[model samples]
Target: MSLPLAIISYLILGESDTWFTTLGTYLYFILLPVFWVGYTVGKKILGIRIVNLDETDVSFWTMIKRQLIANIFYILTLGIGVIVSAFMVGIREDKRAIHDFIAGTYVTFHPPWQK
Candidate 1:
């Protein structure tokens, strides 16, 4: 999703290639500590939010670890790892993907009425 969005941003912005948007998007998501709002814009619209394994608020470093395990390394493998991770989610009762396992985080529903 992030990579696709970055590619779209790159195309819309008249960029030469996806490198800039991809790298920038990766850096922004991985390095920044976007707390409080666990969901990105799309996730918020979908009522999904990322949380720690213990259902606690996550810190900056935790997000970093998440991005590394779930996004960067997985994506670096030409999406093979991400595909496997998706299967992990489907096979598990808890629905935690490999990324969730690696990052010590999971996603939960955010009903609109709750917040």
Candidate 2:
């Protein structure tokens, strides 16, 4: 999604649109899952779902808190926080991003064979 948005923005608005497009793309991922469902449009389509760390239901308020810490906070540090979060996800054995940890949540995939 970020790739596609960045591509379109580059084609239409030149290189300067790259940052805006990138941020917008990330914001979209944050918004949909927190407000609409427990997954972004892409995640929903791919059978990926987000859940509480304890395998319990997560309320809307918790999701909002999660997004604030995970994504929105990036703006406070000029994206350094976001970079760090990505790095944490890459290095951590559990693959949980900083936002996941902050929100106390987990992302999982639903297997077709199981469901």
Candidate 3:
């Protein structure tokens, strides 16, 4: 995502560290997911979607908490939290990662109509 903008910026301006890259990052991580009802490009490709625990539509602030706020803790742990989240998803009955718990959401293969 950011790679394309970074490459273009490098070609055009001889620099990759610019607002274009940042915009790409935000578009990929934040806006796209919120607008798509928690399905990012990869998730959509994989036929997965995120839904709130109560089976409601995911709001922008909820996605922010899930994607951004919970990620801060993972970064704080220097990737250990990410490992834990992977393990939790693999081992837990609900198959939810740390971010899902934090945001009161979960990933599901069920289509929206079923929910």
lDDT preference between candidates 1 and 3, better one: 3
Best model per lDDT: 3
Residue 28, model 2: Cα distance from true site in angstroms: 6.5
What ranking of all candidate models by lDDT puts the best one first? 3, 2, 1
Residue pairs in collision within model 3: none
User: What is the C-alpha local distance difference test score of each model?
Assistant: 0.69, 0.71, 0.85
Distance from true location, Cα of 79 in model 2, Å:
0.8
C-alpha TM-score for every candidate: 0.68, 0.61, 0.84
Give per-candidate clash totals: 0, 0, 0
Model 2 Cα lDDT, one tens digit per residue, 33-113: 766446777777888777777655456766766876566677887999888888977898877877787789877774323
Residue 46: error of model 3 in Å?
A: 0.9
TM-score of model number 2: 0.61
Candidate 1 lDDT over 1-115, as tens digits, reads: 4666666776787764566676666665654425445666666777787777767655677777777656767868888988888888888888888767777877889532354
Better of 1 and 2 by TM-score: 1
